[model samples]
Structure formats: C-alpha cells, structure tokens
Target: MPMPATALQEQLITAVRQNDAAAITRLLAEGADANAPDGRGFTPLVLAAYDDHLEATRALLAGGADPNRPVGGGNTVLMGVAFKGHTGMAQLLLDHGAELNARNGEGSTALMFAVLFGRHEFLDLLLAAGADATLRDNKGQSARDLARQKGNDHALTVLPE
Candidate 1:
C-alpha cells in the first residue's frame, strides 16, 4: 500500500503552493520537511520558486529545503524557476548555492530550459550565476542552440558565442 501523506506534510505543500508564507513558516517551525517532495517529486521550495512566491521560497530555504534537490524527471529548483521565468527566485537559489550547471535526466540544464522556454530574464540570471553556455543536453543541444531552434532572439543574445 502507498504511504499515506502526513497532515503536516499536506498542509506544508498547500501552504507553499498557495504562497502562504506565514503558514509555511509555522509548519517549518513545527518541524515539517521543507524538502519534502510531493507526488510529482516537486519540493515546496521548487513549487514556490516556480510560482514566483519569493516570500514562500525564502521561508522554505530558511527551513532547509535543499536548493539542489531534483524533482519531476530530474528537474532541479533552478530548472523550475527558470522555466517559470522567475528571475528573482532563480537568483535566490543561485545565491543559496544551487548548482547552475545541474543537468536533468534529459541532460538539459536550467540555462537550456530558460532559453528554450523564452525566459530571457531567467536566462540572464542563470548566465550571471555562471551557467556554462557550452553545456549540451542529451541531444547535444546547447543553450544557444535551443534558443536558435526556438527562435528566441532575446535569449540568443544572452548566450555566449
């Protein structure tokens, strides 16, 4: 039988997903796992960061959510923030020591996802975090290549030639 979700864990997840920073703080203070992954492998930090919930993200990080934790399909918090175009959250993760060049299961890094998804601001933030422009995905596609393929001119400009 599948393990039942704990009430505290469920409340924590709801709080983060809803951007309820106050409730999140309370849950964390009560010893909830900030890094707990939901059914989709998405941690509270990842969800908040993806939703641009800066306060919630800050709360989770303060509570010890592993900034480098990988979620759905090897997607890190950085990748989620990048895909969602949350530059501030992306920068926050980087400042908290997130791996800028971390690759997902598909070998796509946050930089690649930012470019492919047209998240120019996030691409810029990732670059500033020292993400390698030359890093390639499983298909051997670099961030620059993905930008070009997707015709995201703004993203193309952020990439190193």
Candidate 2:
C-alpha cells in the first residue's frame, strides 16, 4: 500500500494540478518533498508534466524531484511527457536523466507512446536520446510495428533502421 501523503505534499500536488508555478516554487522552497506521490501515485513532477505545466514541471525538477519517477500505472514522467506530446517537457525529463527506454506496466516505452500518438516532435528527441525503437510492448509490438499499425508512416521513418 502507498504511504499517506503529508500535508505539504498534498499542497504541492494541488499546486501542480492547478499549474500554479508560483505556488509550486513557494512550496518547494518550504522543503516539501518534490517526489511525493498523490493518492493515485502522481508525483508533482508527473502531474505537472501530464498537465503540460512546463514552468511547474521545471520548479519541481529544480526542487530535486526524480525525473524518472513512476506515476499512474507505472508510467514514468517521460511517458506522461510523451503521451501528452509535450516535446519540451520530454527534453527536460531527458536532461534530468529520465530513462529513455523505461517501460511501463504494459512494457510500453516513451518511444512507443510517441509513435502510437503520432507525436512526431517527440520522436526525434526520444530517438536521438537512444530510445530503443526495437523494444517491444506486452503485445509484442515494437515502436515501428505500432507506428505501422497506427498508419503513422512518418513515425516509422523516425524509428531505428
């Protein structure tokens, strides 16, 4: 079972959900745990990334949140960034050492999400960062296979040759 969240962590999560960068900064300064997860396993960083709150995401990262922290369903922060098509947030996570090929519970990598969603902007970034295009999901579908299934020809071109 997940540990109960501290009041400060809850407040920080609220700031993240609201996309309140200023509030996030203040809470971080007050020594709130940037890596603390909400009731559903969403860390402040993951929440900010999922919401496309770039500034709030940055604040959380600066506050020492783990960029590789797993959120809902064992998806990493990079997964949220990729799923949301937030290329800039993806870059931020990459710069902070988020695993390029980290797999979620379904064994889906960030590159797979980029391909599945046709997030071409993130495709190049994930590819260049060494996201293994050949990594297969639980369904035995590689990123290339997923792109092909989705009829995302452009994404297929970005995958490893």
The prediction achieving the highest TM-score against the true structure is 1
State each model's C-alpha RMSD to the native. Answer: 3.3, 3.8
Q: Give the TM-score of candidate 2.
A: 0.88
Q: Candidate 2 at 143: error in angstroms?
A: 0.6
Badly placed stretches (over 4 Å) of model 2 are: 1-5
Clashes of each: 0, 0
Per-residue CA lDDT of model 1 for 36-112, tens digit only, reads 88887778887888789998988888888899988878989888877778887877888888998999999999888
Candidate 1: deviation at residue 26, Å?
2.1
1-161 in candidate 2: lDDT tens per residue?
A: 44334767888888888888889888878778898777776778888888888888888887898987777778998888788899988888888889998999999999998898889989988888777887889989898888878999988676766
Q: lDDT scores for all predictions?
A: 0.85, 0.84
